[model samples]
Target: MSTTETNSGTAPAQSASALASKNPATGDVISVHAIQSPEEVRAAVERARSAARSWNALGFDGRKQHLLRWVSYLLDHADELSELIHAENGKPVDDAYLELVLAVEHIAWAAKHAKKVLSPKKVAPGLLMANFSAVIEQHPLGVIGVIGPWNYPVYTPMGSIAYALAAGNSVVFKPSEYTTAVGNYLADSFRLANPELREHILTTVNGYGETGAALVTSGVNKIAFTGSTPTGKRIMAAAAESLTPVLLECGGKDAAIVAADADVKAAADAIAFGAMANSGQTCVGVERVYVDKRVSDEFITEIKKIIRDLKPGDAEGASYGPMTMPSQIDIVRSHIEDALEHGGRAVVGGADSVKERYIEPVVIVDADETCSAVVEETFGPTLTIRTVDSADEAIELANASRFGLASTVFSKNHGMEIARRLRAGATSVNSVLGFAAIPALPFGGVGESGIGRIHGEWGLKEFTRPHAIANQRFAIPGMALLSFKRTKMTTSLVKQTMKLLHGRYK
Candidate 1:
């Protein structure tokens, strides 16, 4: 690893062209970044492409070693990385550190398991191809273009990046317009660990929508994009021009069900954290809550108490920071207003909580299904509470949304039963967003929640293509359709064999 730094310790001045990263809590400038041009992005992709060939040729053991070294580096410098994440994304230090920890685990998981999961496995060729032996292997798809979002920036993107690298594909990462500095820090750290593979291994382009579009159209072999559903659709369309495959991780209107048998306090606390942490910028954050009518009043009161205790600021002592994106303030305001206008009550915080860059936790109750706050992906520190007669009703309401990323069931019994009917990719019983922490479980959703899985063995295969190869072991004359010669006797024998093999009746 070289101490050689490219454009470190120096940043573009705070000008019109600079993307200024602000502290979500205090609204102070944490760093300034220059949005790279399209040509510069092209160069970065080309460098990654060159690096990928050599990096990919290193075989599984060599790649695993490099990944382990990278993990070691992250552990050695965990504090520094945590601070950078906090400064860039405006979450509390604990949240940042936790994300870094999860990322480290993801990196290690991808490294240690990629070989076993992606390597070829023998399969029976079957009676049709009885003379052949077949094997299926997952092959690297070459360069992958990754577009990340701001919330859990490290954890979310690494789900794609680490897995892609493990699958032997180089990545050209373009982080959110709001969190470019975090992207830069990660890419730079990788270079520090694997200097020889620096060019082919990783490269970052920091910018906004234009930069992301450039990456999507940059002729990469595949695109792994995580953001809003609309953006995911756009990325898919752009990649369609090149017929490039994509793994889209998009938005969610996730719900948390509080059954009659659930603990009110525990459910409330889970709701508070799942909705307000990261200022609710998380894709799988719980935006809607369906509480049993039997416990609706008690649950709402407890949840309000939890929201009241959550303080949002840029100070060191705060639990959460501001909305990282300056424009999100308006979005948050609009959603709160829409809820209020629709007869919803903000029991704790309301439109008044929407500050310049920060938003206090808002818990809205009596929200109708048609309200935007209840239906839309309100990526803010706000939640909508609804009541239903039974757990079945809760599942029905949760599955009604087009987005089905992750859902939670809080019940002493029937938790798993209700979870199964939710139509989401993942469900956490008696917990919120707990599936994401388990490295072995697949993480992703069906429908609008996005396409493709991002964690576990599924993640490792998302960046690779399954290649099936068959070898002929022996030849049987007149045993199959390979020859058009006289085969009346052979045909009778084949039909009898087929019937015996399949155990079919007359």
Candidate 2:
């Protein structure tokens, strides 16, 4: 690993005109893309704005036809796309395929349900205004600017891309520099699937931070970003200048609770996979655990057995693959050293587990709450376990982190109760990441984890706004409350009605 050369997916600008995409495992250049300047970004947004008009004119049924065709295209090209994901993103080919499967599920959900979810519906006009019929209509925001991450390039960005498109809006996406070619392929496939449609319905802007900054202020109606918490904050602050709405999915130090009643073997297996899968680059991956003292030793022993056998490589039978970003290697290394320096001990693998690009799964026990490994978002294959006296203690420890993204509970009898007690946007009971596979559930985090929800009904609604319409049926001349010519008798009647309906409750 070279300290002087590090790329965080969203790396600094190397050339004024081009960005190269490279394979993380072999350091081989996959492809090169042209950097879109600020002027080019604006032009792209304008094109998208024009495309949005035609897109919305197609209506829900027409759009669904196109989206479903896109789904077919994705399925047809699954092998080719998965291979690209494996080489550029440094994840196992099977893991890449699973990511694609989840992404396809979201795309299908957003397409099949958009019309029903976004249709105008009658809203009740209460007794105070019974003469008017009211309805709320969903209106699509013109153009959306999406800034995506490299970890799960297809799945993560498609959360925004699929939902936004279904809601009748055009999009301009700025994919991470590390996976530029993969991003381009997604947009290109959309056009290929629907050749009769306009090209500007979806587009890509290639470059580093400057390209992203330009998109935020490119006269787009909304901006959706997925990355670190610090980057989320900066994007929010910049978007505030134009009052551009943002949907951010940021960093998470997610935790899991293992109760004494949990199935020991099942809990251990799930934890082992949850913590180390995708090289632990998942934003919602399990990084910490709190187990009851009675079951702590057993859980640790079972998990260690699983970790010792798993290996990371680009070979045919590797458990996982190399770290996608070069710079993240340093962060993972420092966290392990910090954990050991602060009196925490590794029961499985220690600092030596961290190699140049691949990191062996390390499990730390007795780590203090203040240790960097426990406190920060370590994008590596590592775990920190602490013993607790009861479920109350476990819940308290799990909720102590600044992030409230996702959590899991392993309990035979009290899993649901414990999950409800934990502070998180989503909770899985006796399982890991159950909510992610179900496209009907919305996914997002609270606090430092970022704002807004994606997937399911809420995900479709995020790209549109409501418009309320009130149509008058008939006017009672004497009881016209909104008119200046209302008589004293009507005012007296209105006062009496108000007291009868509301004032009596007190």
Name the best candidate (by TM-score).
2
Model 1 scores worst on lDDT over the 10 consecutive residues at 1-10
TM-score of each: 0.94, 0.98
Q: Candidate 1 clashing pairs? A: 24-322, 25-313, 25-314, 26-314, 51-200
Q: How many backbone clashes does candidate 1 have?
A: 5
In the range 1-506, model 2's lDDT, one tens digit per residue, is 11111123336346889888999898898998999999999999999999999999999999999999999999999999999999999898899999999999999999999999999999899987999999999999999999988888999899999999999999999998888888998999999999999889999998888888889888999999988887788788888999999998888899999999999999999988889999988888899999999999999999989988999899878989998887798889999999999888899899999888899889999898899999999989999999999999999889998999999899999998998888898998888999999988999999998899999999999999999999999997789899899899999999999999999776
In candidate 2, position 144 carries an lDDT of 95
Clashes per candidate (backbone, < 3 Å) = 5, 0
lDDT score, candidate 1, position 375: 83
C-alpha local distance difference test of each model = 0.84, 0.90
- TM-score, structure 1 vs. true: 0.94
Assess candidate 1 and give its lDDT. Answer: 0.84
